[model samples]
Target: MSDSQHHNEEEQAKIRTSRALAALTIAANAQISVEDACASVVDESGDEGLDAIGITLARGEIYVVQAKASSGSPSPTEVLKFNQGIRYLLDWDWDSLGGKTQKRRGEIEAASEDDVKVIAIFSHFGAQKTDEAATKLSDKLLSEVNSSGNILDFQYQGLRENHDNRNIASGLGLPDYDLVFERWITMNDYRSEIMGVVTGDQLARMVDSFNERLFDKNIRAVLKATDTNKILDATLERSPQDFWYYNNGITIVSNSISCARTSPRTADETFKLQGLSVVNGAQTCGALGRALRENAPLEDVRVTVRVMSKEGHSEDFTKKVTRYTNTQNQVTNREFVSLDPYQQELSESLLSEQIQYSFRTGQTLDYDEHAFAFDLEEATRALACLTGVDNATRAKREIGRMWSDITANPYRELFPRNLHPATMYNAVQFRRVFDERYMASSRWMDTRSGGIIKNSTYMACALFMQKARNEKLDFSDIDLDVESWVSSKGADIYGLAAIVVELHENENPGGFPMSFFKNRQKIEEFARKVRTRFQETGS
Candidate 1:
């Protein structure tokens, strides 16, 4: 060994150290571990393949982030690689057959079923252009999640010029993360829509029940915008036997808008006409008092004085006066709380002017869609009359939730056995489908129907489908492998089942000889037994 040679080797080592340091610096800046970031690799062997590195642990259903590192910018490409590696690590089953890979996290090897999850952390990997690979992996994920007809979603910041991955996910019916976020916003909107239909305790109980039923289920059950309208509607309709799973962990009810309004009026008031001031007489010279145009009918008009007579007392007054009435008096008949000649006439003129404008526009009630929107409108009007909190968004949301719950979620836990098994299944399916769809779809309010209801539209659609399937009952040419045909045919099956059950129930409501919906007790027992059976079967 020559000294010169030793110096050359030292120089090479310094370069390697600098490159590694740069990688770490980049990862930190990107807010990802070096393991999550990927440095391009020139070769599979030696340090050329080195990039980021980290370790991870699985917890229940979500992946627990642990020691991880990224080696470059957190670009979309980097995200793809990181996610791919994570998926690979999660799916790996070491005990199955092949020898364990070097990246295997030892702790997971002995974990039981409950402890396992499709989650992982990474330490190191390199960027490799594999559009084909990315496409295949994303497709598989979408298929797996959507096959069961569950809502799927994803979220990311901003927009992209080209997002093949997102497009593919959408085409396969998997919602991007953004969809979930949007649904959450929509859920808030829906809460506002239904908060006016029920009482406070009832709403609270509904939420409590929903949360309780979902507590034992996975977090996946907590999708946004759950259509509590069905349950709420059922309650409102006075159908007592249709409440579904009680403990879903989410808020079940909200305060009604009407319940939240504040009334603050002592009684009716009257105002006598007051002489008009001539402060701006020059401005109105041409039309001192030309025939006044009457817009609104003289009714329930209010007048108020802000100033005080050396004392702090409000000078507000009301009047009921007619406009352009042709009568024997040749004078307009008016009623007022008090006639302080100075205040009464002026107030009446002003009131008349405002009413004229109101009448021209034909201003009336603003229509809403809830079954009981009138009640809320009445409340709003009453509250407005009192004068305090005028517009209450929270109150409305609370009220809407309450009303929706009462209308939906029937309490028929023990459906009579006279109802056929298929009918029972359809009912169960409707509840499930309604819940799932309601959770996913935007709130559909029908003011004409009453007030703002939740997605009873979905249930209505379900019913329609149920009927359609029964009518178009033909599955002789079905081929399960052909995706399009399979889906098309499945719709028919689901619909037919619903209709049959409905007909059976209608035909024999008085203790029909059916196994599933025979009577309250039998149906209840069957539900318990069936649920237990499903659990045993690992469904």
Candidate 2:
């Protein structure tokens, strides 16, 4: 092939890879399926700086992605391209663009700018360059977006970024072998806990080696530098000697830990940990690594490290430890589920009944290990359905709102005191069936009108399932009936959903009404009217 052809092929490959990665990230972060994520992505190939475009359904946020598959950092030209794309998006410029770009632009224009959260993601497969030109370009773009009064968030991910990290069979660039410690001190009875001091150089090496794997179990994503991080950086710069006392230390989890102590009585020892990972203190560790890369003076800096073996610990227990250690920092309420004894018991009960249950979001349970597992968001929606919440399905997509309700409501009342494992399983299964049925109409549902109508459809389906199973139906019976009903009347049900969507839109033209999904009486009355209409049609 000619050189031009080769370059084109390379760019095409990057586009394909970046789109796939962006879809996966959306699915994992949004707790949706890979297929759903792909469906949301709009193709705008010739739209200059835009590569992959997706809108997060739950949060009503738009994600504009620019992906570079190169091993080197994105160039100044790439940054300018991204800047131009954002300008077009914000300025509502479409006449200068191609048909596909204009079409996508129209869809975005339908939503009010205030309601939309625009996230610009620049992804590459190597470390991002922070040289003068690149940095200046980035600052200019960021400043323009900031001054535009738009809710725009910029995220840059490189090969070392956690967006690419996952615990898969193929091992997505995670390091192999154990991280060794030259001198350590045991802190527990079973030799599972060890505490020691690590030099700044050693800390940087570990971060470079493990990268995103260090935060495998963390509930939150790796955040940008905040005011807290600034303080830590200043401390590291000025008082390297006081670093150990100022910092809370790092916590790590591993499959096993082996120690070869240099002395019998002294605290000095050499420790080697296998399958090691930092479950907590990701920000602190990340900051230290960045500082070291910038050539910070830290030869004498000694940061405390705690390593715990997961040999005797259940996954649930390990997660709890991570949750507790991270409490000093800002985290989502969902992260605190590990501290709930009822959640732990619920997980255990489900396991005993041969069902896999994960209380945390973004966790993948192998089907071979268990019969069924529900994502936390899915389970939350089911609970909402079972309890007669009007827009219960909406809770599945709204993490902050869901967290608020979860913390405010009594656990016994929100989740029944004597909840049966089978019932919980059935609720999740019912929601899954409903989702599958609705998604089958994706050809229409992927359109703007269809997308607006989708959430109401989900709520309606959940209500339908609840009403069907009201008479103490068995799990198998409920599943069969739901499947049959969906197969026969799915289209009519979706039509009803579209009607509900119209009603809401007409009532509140600015956005979806807050009362639309919250009022139990209103929702049930709408459902009754839909049922009456279905009966009258008698198809």
Candidate 3:
């Protein structure tokens, strides 16, 4: 091969690697799967100035990347090309772009114009401090994009070395802070905590450098600007100097924290914190970064961060701290479950029994090892049924409200101190069976019929399980017979449920109220009638 051809191939390989790294960074930052990130990428060939595109479904935002793997700063022309690419994306000028870009446009066209658009420029060579012309070009492009009445943001990330990419790939890794100033201080009744303060610029750099991985351990979901966030933004805007006084410091929990104080003369210290994650004040941190990016007077802002060492601390203890620190907002039952010691014990027990149990929301369960794992939310719903909560079947439809109910009253009784993990496990398995059998039946096609059938079937399954437990029968031993019974009697059961639904609808012609189902007495009466009919048919 010619020398020039070999060099071109080498450059292409580098570009491919950089693009893949960029994709991983996007996935890590967005908290999405790599496959999803890859799906959003626009082909490099005939690519209209954009290297890749990533869409965050949860945040309703799109990220367009322009990555350069060169050993030096990206040229002014390269910056201009990046700018032009964003323009094309914003203007929806698909005709001027390649098919892949056009396809991406179509994928995101359903998103509202108000959705956020972030243009990220990634470079192996540092884009900070050097490349003044490139910075100017970026500013010009951002101004143009912002003037178009779109919620747009521009971020320049310079990964100075290959190790930088590796750091980003690890979801919990910290960005390269400008100056790590660490100090040891003892709190009352606790081991000394490592306190560090970073300037607003450094915080902004960290936010721009990494993804949501920083706040991965936080209990609360990513919040949009709330009253609290607004207050934080205002404080940063008006009195950035008093930021430390005005704001409660951020709390971070990590497995280990290390610091090297090189010189007594210099206050700067090099700190390496491993398995680090922000447990509290995620919104505050996010707002600070936003304020700095939006030209808030944050250059002098010094934010204090409290780092608690996770050494000698149990995972449950760390989770408890995380849960307590986030009590300013209404903590969900699922969040509570995640911190409950009993829940952790149950999860471990289930794991030992070859059954997966996820006490945390959004935790992935390996279905191959275990038939299924119940997330706290799903487990709560099943518990609601087992405890005889009115309209327990409605938990499937209104999961959020059901959680609130589960945390209170008759529903909460289901999670008594001495409650066995087997009861909860069996309830989940029964619900899964009901769901599978009901959905598979031909009766599921009709919307009205399907709704009634679902509620009745759940009631039937719950009653059967309760009866089995009362009689001290092996629940799994009767699984085959139960499945057969449900399969055969599904139509008859639905027919009875349909009659009940029709009666309720006729009684209140002004649309059937959900209160009708909330009547436990009425549902029990229907369930008894269905059971009697099934018994007569069997005899």
Whole-model Cα lDDT per candidate?
0.25, 0.59, 0.59
Best by lDDT: 2
TM-score of each: 0.18, 0.40, 0.38
lDDT of 2 by residue, 1-539 (tens): 12224457767675566667656544443333345556545445456676656553224366776666667777888888887776566545565444455766655665422245678877677665544686587676666454424356777777766344333312433233343454566755425787777776677677655444445545334423333454567778888888888777788877777645543333434466777667776767766776776788777777788888888777776778877876664544566666666777778877876778888755787689886777566676776666554546335334334544344553344465567666677777777777676655545542433444554555666655655565455543323354555456576656555565555545433233322443355556655665565445542
lDDT of 3 by residue, 291-371 (tens): 756767667888777777778777686687788887764344346555557778878877777779887766888888885
Tens-place lDDT digits, model 1, residues 416-443: 2132322222332333343344333222
* lDDT measured at residue 254 in model 3 versus the true structure, 0 to 100: 70
Those runs of model 1 whose alpha carbons end farther than 4 Å from true positions after fitting are 1-61, 64-76, 84-414, 417-465, 468-539
Q: Could you give me the TM-score of model 1 versus the true structure?
A: 0.18
- Worst 10 contiguous positions by lDDT, candidate 1: 174-183
Candidate 3 residue 130 Cα shift, in angstroms, is 22
Q: Would you list the rank order by lDDT, best first?
A: 2, 3, 1
Q: Which regions of candidate 2 are displaced past 4 Å? A: 1-331, 360-364, 389-397, 400-413, 470-492, 501-505, 508-539
Q: Which pairs clash (backbone N, Cα, C closer than 3 Å) in model 2?
A: none
